[model samples]
Target chain A: MVLDFYFDFASGYSYFAARRIEWLAAAHGAKVRWHPVLLPALTQVTGVLPSPVVPVKWAYVTRDMQRTAQEEAIPFNPSPAFPQMLIAPGRAMLWVRANHGEEVAVSFARTCFQAYYADAVDIADKAVLLGIAEGLGIDGSAFLAGMEDPAIKSQFKEGNERALAQGVFGVPFVIAEGEPFWGYDRFGNLERWLAAARKVA
Target chain B: MVLDFYFDFASGYSYFAARRIEWLAAAHGAKVRWHPVLLPALTQVTGVLPSPVVPVKWAYVTRDMQRTAQEEAIPFNPSPAFPQMLIAPGRAMLWVRANHGEEVAVSFARTCFQAYYADAVDIADKAVLLGIAEGLGIDGSAFLAGMEDPAIKSQFKEGNERALAQGVFGVPFVIAEGEPFWGYDRFGNLERWLAAARKVA
Candidate 1:
């Protein structure tokens, strides 16, 4: 069974899930389809804006991320710069998938989340995307050239549309064989559902 | 330190927390201030409304609850009657608290949650509450009579208002002294907060 892990580079919980998604999927004997989507489009559809706009949500996300990171034994310093622009990195992610395989795209997504969340880097800038791409051993010029392509930009918009069509309203949403499960917390249940689906088939 | 446990009788996660609140509080040398408020009112103030009303939130809650339940090794059969109407039971909870001692009130709150969520008993009716009162050794007449009193009714409203004032928007909200922690998942953090508070004092 393959689980479609729909994630965004700027989401904190996505960072938490990316750290263990591969290990967990391997343990459950499930294949993961790493998906990158624009969080802004998702928010518009679900009436969920960037949490920073809502003070309560912002506070909740901050505390929530802290608790989750502590639970995962990862050092996470919540940045004030979050819910910032991800247009560059997001399009760059689409570029990776177009030029490279799913593996490179997924790895780049993981690196971007870590760079932004753990390393407290501003992921919206071209320099940051280039740094992330170079750090992952991908050719810098190809990645930069791909980022400027309108096709890569269109792919992100299409990905966002696909996510909206699937009724996904949040990041780290996993759709396993058409059953959409939202959030990092849903990973286990998504796996269970996938396993059950596989067994039934 | 005394922990104010804000909960509703109809809440599933509240039931999950109810069974362990007393023991856990006692273990940590913390006293429990059982704050029974109508979940709906709190939801309005906290912006945590019924899942069915918001598709994304609905999905998040379902998956999140399932994950937490499994991790806690608790049985979690999510009832179709989620975001259950608690107007009657909620008023009764306030009525009991006004006339009864803290311990009895707390037990009643816990039992109500347990009966509805854990035991699958119908707690939407007055008979169930009467039975619960009788079990608690309270005068069933006075308990029932108290529900009609204007003062008691007002207190119920005030409880909801107070919960909102405390930044609580959901059930099983624990306020360790003045620091508010929402849901059963925050229990461990509440404990640590109390321990640190005690050290400082």
Candidate 2:
């Protein structure tokens, strides 16, 4: 079975989930469809305010992400300027997926996650994104062009629309056997569900 | 060390956390102080919208609660009408603590959680709350009178104010060593923190 893993680049929780989902999916003999979604677009459609704008939640998220990162053994030194503009890297993920393949796209997405979340790089900047793409053996010029392509932009919009249609309101939302598990913390329950489904199969 | 567990009666996540925290804290040689806060009052002070009012979040919360309950092995059949009015029970908990003592009050709070979350009882109803109190060997007439007591109402207000002063913006918030862990999902992290603190001691 396939797990539809919906995520947004700007979300720290999504970064945490991205680091682990591949191995987690592999353990259950499941395939993951990494769907990059624009969180703001989904929130706009759902009419829910972003957590960063909510002062208390924003503070809690920063602390939670730091502690969770340590628990997961992943480096997480977020940039002081959080909720970084993710449009460029987000669109680039789709661009790579379209041109290279899903494997390369997943790798690209992880690099993006690390660049922003661990290395504190400004992923929103075109130079930094191109640098990340070049390191991944993706042609810098083609990658830059793909990111700006109107078709790629449209694809990103379609991804957001599809996420909203699928009742996904937050990052790291996973859908397995038509059950939606939202958030990185729900991964344990998702794993249990997957194990139960496998046994039934 | 004391693990201050801040929660609200109306929160499903809080119920999930409530079921596990005491034992978890005891395992680490820690004492638990259960502080029940009115969520609406905290949200108003923090200028954040309630999750139930946020359509996408409310949808996620219901699904998350069900999955979490299964993982925790707790009975969780949410009332058809959710975001139950928690004032009567909230005040009643403080009254029980003031007169009966902390241990009995914790039992009283757990019963309230099961009454609303498991049995789907209307905890807002005065009769229903009094019945729950009486079941716990609490004086039903006194509990009824306590619910209407101005002193209890003022104490409830004080609880909300204290929560706000402590920077509590959400339910199931656990504070230890001046660090806050928000959400029931973060209980794992909280447990880890407690263990580390104990080792140092």
Model 1 Cα lDDT, one tens digit per residue, B47-116: 4445556776666666666666776687665434555667677778777776786677777877777677
**What are the candidates' individual DockQ scores?**
0.24, 0.46
Q: Which segments of model 1 are wrong by more than 4 Å?
A: A43-49, A78-80, A137-142, A175-181, A185-201, B45-48, B55-82, B177-179, B188-201
Instruction: State the C-alpha lDDT per candidate.
Output: 0.75, 0.85
Judged by lDDT against the true structure, how good is candidate 2? Answer: 0.85
**Residue pairs that clash (backbone atoms under 3 angstroms), model 2:** none
Q: Tens-digit lDDT track for model 2 on A4-91?
A: 9999889999988998898989999999999999888887655656778877777777877888888778898876656865788889
Tell me the lDDT of candidate 1: 0.75
Worst 10 residues of 1 chain B by lDDT: B43-52
What are the per-model C-alpha RMSD values against the true structure?
3.7, 2.0
Model 2 chain B weakest 10-residue run by lDDT: B42-51
